[model samples]
Target: MGEPNTILHAVRVSLRMSQDELAQAIREDGREHGEPNYCAKRNVQRWESGDVRMPRKIYIRSLERVTGLPIEALGFATPVFGTRAAAQAPANGQESARGEVVEMGATSAPGGAVPMTKHNDHGTLSGIWLSRYEYHSSGRGADFTGEHFVVVIQHRNKLTVRSLPEASSNPDSPLTMDLTVDGNVVTGSWREETAGDGYYAGAVYHGALQLLLEPTGRKMTGKWVGFGKDFDVNTGPWELTFKDASTSKAAMDRYNHRP
Candidate 1:
């Protein structure tokens, strides 16, 4: 087997994120950029085991965004042009599909401008969050409350939030939200897949949402309008609160088991 990618592994550990969390983060990041990604725990395992020396270009971009590190620094070999390697290179001034020129010593990190620091600030919504919602069920004629552990990733004006499974062995009934930030208002859409054995009978739900960011930037309060199991339009209050700046396993467990 090839040498293990300790650099990649170490960075993930420092961020207090597990392999599964990293994979989910990367997948969410790809979706934010309109890229379809199938990243999973198995992919992270291969990368850390050195079974795959270099991932595809889309994964590379996601890695850069999640880790705030340059590809070369992550133990990946960037192709250097000129010398014998440039013999088969594209002609000069010719750009790749992404408009990047393949030339001698042209290795540039996608997020080189961003400082390599732990994301612990409120300036960007890139961390763990607690999602809570309350809605009245027509069948029961009572209010129902739900909570979830979610990871929020913000890339520029775009934000993606995805719920995490309670445990590795448990199946995920994922809830995903895609939102855009304009000043202090966040407008977005949300989709959720109900648990198969739950009260909803594994129904799929989706709707539009709009939230106002609190002055502290640690809380978002909003309302969601969606079709319920009865096929009737329902509205409810939804909120997301900043929980932890780190995605460590301990943080995840704490949020998952919240009271």
Candidate 2:
């Protein structure tokens, strides 16, 4: 009816929610790198009214989830985050001002928020993505029964993941694994520690995860291996998709790390 509302404001309206409702929802998502009350209603007003230059990556990521709107549609100019800036980011769990995810930056528009920075050769691995793997032994013939719930965290180019078995006694327990990306492919390994035995037959569980980026850049598919005494003993396939497509809403597992 009237002139179109500002991009951020329009998104909030499209969801039939008030600014306070969206603000409260964003605060609860709670980015590990964000501050207390960071997404206050006043801040939302600022972003909606064009008072702020660019929303930081943390808020951008959280708001995407809160509003179910793509960050690019919010209309802020994306800024490129350099290596120096990333290295200089706060070390006390606080994050620096980052817009673009350098090595693994935005490729398209469905999964996470789009970076406002100039396009570059490097790609970014920021934002949330769900990982699913069904592990089975070579001769076990169990129809890939070992299922692990996994989530990936991409900050700049460095990546980390926390995974736990679906039937695990310790669902609160997460195995911290790290990986690096080469082109669309990502590979890494982590050693796991648990009080009880693993989901597999033996008590030991250590493995490598490989992911191939889809053309849409929002999804990845790969295989993972659960190595035992001789290495690469147990193997299976895994898939990673954005939060919206995931049945497992356990998307924020990255913040579960303890000091």
Highest lDDT model number: 1
TM-score, per-candidate, Cα-based = 0.55, 0.40
lDDT of 2 by residue, 1-259 (tens): 1111144543453343577888888888765435444677876765655445356667878877775446754545444435776655432221245422222222422223552343213455444445555754456655643323444444444454544333232443335456666667778765455445544433546777887877676777888777655564766787766643221224233322221
Off by over 4 Å in 1: 1-122, 167-172
Instruction: State the lDDT of candidate 1 residue by residue for 162-202, as single tens digits.
Output: 67666211144556677777778889888777778877777
Measured on C-alpha atoms, candidate 2 has an lDDT of 0.52
Candidate 1 has which clashing residue pairs, if any? 16-248
lDDT of all predictions, in order shown?
0.69, 0.52
The candidate that wins on TM-score is 1
How displaced is residue 46 in candidate 2, in Å?
28
Per-candidate clashes, comma-separated: 1, 7
